[model samples]
Target: MTAWVRGRVQGVGFRWWTRARALELGLTGWAANLRDGRVEVVAEGPRESCEKLLAALRGGDTPGEVEGVVERWSDAKRSMVGFVEK
Candidate 1:
């Protein structure tokens, strides 16, 4: 599944936080900053792993404040080589 997260998701180590969680959960995906001050996440993995990713993205163990989250399920067609910041 893929998610397009918005709100104060930039300049606050949001990408790095996501990268760590994705790696820890063995998820394959890419996360980057959007020009519109939002964060874009494309991830694929086991169903459980994807759930964990969603939880983290929605506010897991991270110290940052996640005011809100916008989630969407996609085709999972994209293959992630590595988690990156863009």
Candidate 2:
């Protein structure tokens, strides 16, 4: 699953947050900041894993509040690389 997340996500360690959570869930993908002040995430794994990642991205059991989450499927190739901020 993929997400084009907006709102007050940038400059708040959103990418770092996602990397940590994704690693915890054993997910593989990339999360980066868009030029338009949004966060673009590309994730791949089992459906359950993807859902968990999305849920965490939306609003995890953390202090950061996710203002909004826009999820969608994408044709991007899955990364065999480790999670990292980009």
Candidate 3:
């Protein structure tokens, strides 16, 4: 699954927070800051776990306000080992 998180997502430790969250959920992928001030995240794991992460992302964590979350699902290409901030 790939997600684009908008609104107050850049800086404020958003990438780190997302990395930790994904790791906690045992999801593997990456999160990175976009030029348009959005955060792009790609994660692969159990459907339920991915859903949980999406919920949390939409709800926002500390220091960042999650204005929106847009997601797209696709078939897994390569297996990921750990979540990271890219």
Q: What is the lDDT for 68 in model 2?
A: 79
In candidate 3 the C-alpha lDDT for residue 52 amounts to 89
Give the local distance difference test score of model 3: 0.89
Provide the global lDDT of candidate 1 against the true structure.
0.78
Q: Stretches of candidate 1 above 4 Å error?
A: 60-63
Model 2 agreement with the true structure over 1-86: per-residue lDDT tens digits: 87887777888888888888888888788899899988888787777888898888766553345667899975547646777778
Question: Model 3: which ten-residue window has the lowest total lDDT?
Answer: 58-67
The parts of candidate 2 lying over 4 Å away from their true place are 60-65, 74-79
- Model 2 collision count: 0
The sequence of per-residue lDDT tens digits that candidate 1 reaches over residues 1-86 is 77777767788888888888888988888888889877888778877888888888776455456666777776666556767777
CA lDDT, candidate 3, residue 50: 90
Error of 2 at 68 (Å): 1.3
TM-score of each: 0.83, 0.84, 0.93
Least accurate stretch of 10 residues (summed lDDT) in model 1? 59-68
Residue pair clashes in candidate 1: none
What's the best-to-worst order under TM-score? 3, 2, 1
